[model samples]
Target: MAIPTIRVGLTAATRTMAGTSAVPKYSDKENGIIATDRETGEKLYTVMIFLMEEDRAETLKVTVPANGLPNGLKPGMPVKTVDLVARPWANLFNGQISSGVAYRVSALELDSGE
Candidate 1:
């Protein structure tokens, strides 16, 4: 059973926070839980990006490397993500199936000339 994924590219209007969900300690081996580099031990942070879809505005949460996000990235600033992927996740809770999309990016860069 392979999870389906889709490649995507988007511009970010804002970045909210960066941290791990694990309490007391953080590890690099956990998948779909904590994002981190295997060799460098650098943790990946979850970033919330505001975007415009069609005629409406929406927010997307993506997991990116700690150093991958640009410095001084602020609201209304353009962001480019390479190898951005949207993965579908499903789980059973209370005898019901729940599903959602999980986004991740391999690299992030500030979009200049915007």
Candidate 2:
């Protein structure tokens, strides 16, 4: 039987580190998203990314479905990803500070031959 796959999108903005839970809870204002194949029904993967544009560092979180992911991706699987951070803020720190906004996309490879 062919594995199942699904696509999902999660926002990475407005992240607050909770004292508990290994993963940080992300809000919707960030508008982050993840996508996967629609044939395999597998678990989703979340990726946390940090970027520094000027001075302030921004935290971003993203998720991707791993239904047919290659080699059954684990928690520490190495995946290639890209980042887009928010622009610098004016009238603050002489343009040395920034809002710290960013987004990430994780493409999970599945094993299914679909």
TM-score of each: 0.62, 0.29
In terms of TM-score, how similar is model 2 to the real structure? 0.29
Steric overlap count per candidate: 0, 23
Candidate 1: which pairs clash?
none
Computed on alpha carbons, the lDDT of every model, listed in order, comes to: 0.63, 0.37
lDDT of 1 by residue, 14-53 (tens): 3322222212113444544564666676677766665555
User: What is the Cα-based lDDT of residue 52 in candidate 1?
Assistant: 59
User: Top model by lDDT, which number?
Assistant: 1
Per-residue CA lDDT of model 2 for 7-108, tens digit only, reads 322244322221111232233427753333344643455555443344465454544444213354444333333322222223458657545422323343
TM-score of 1: 0.62
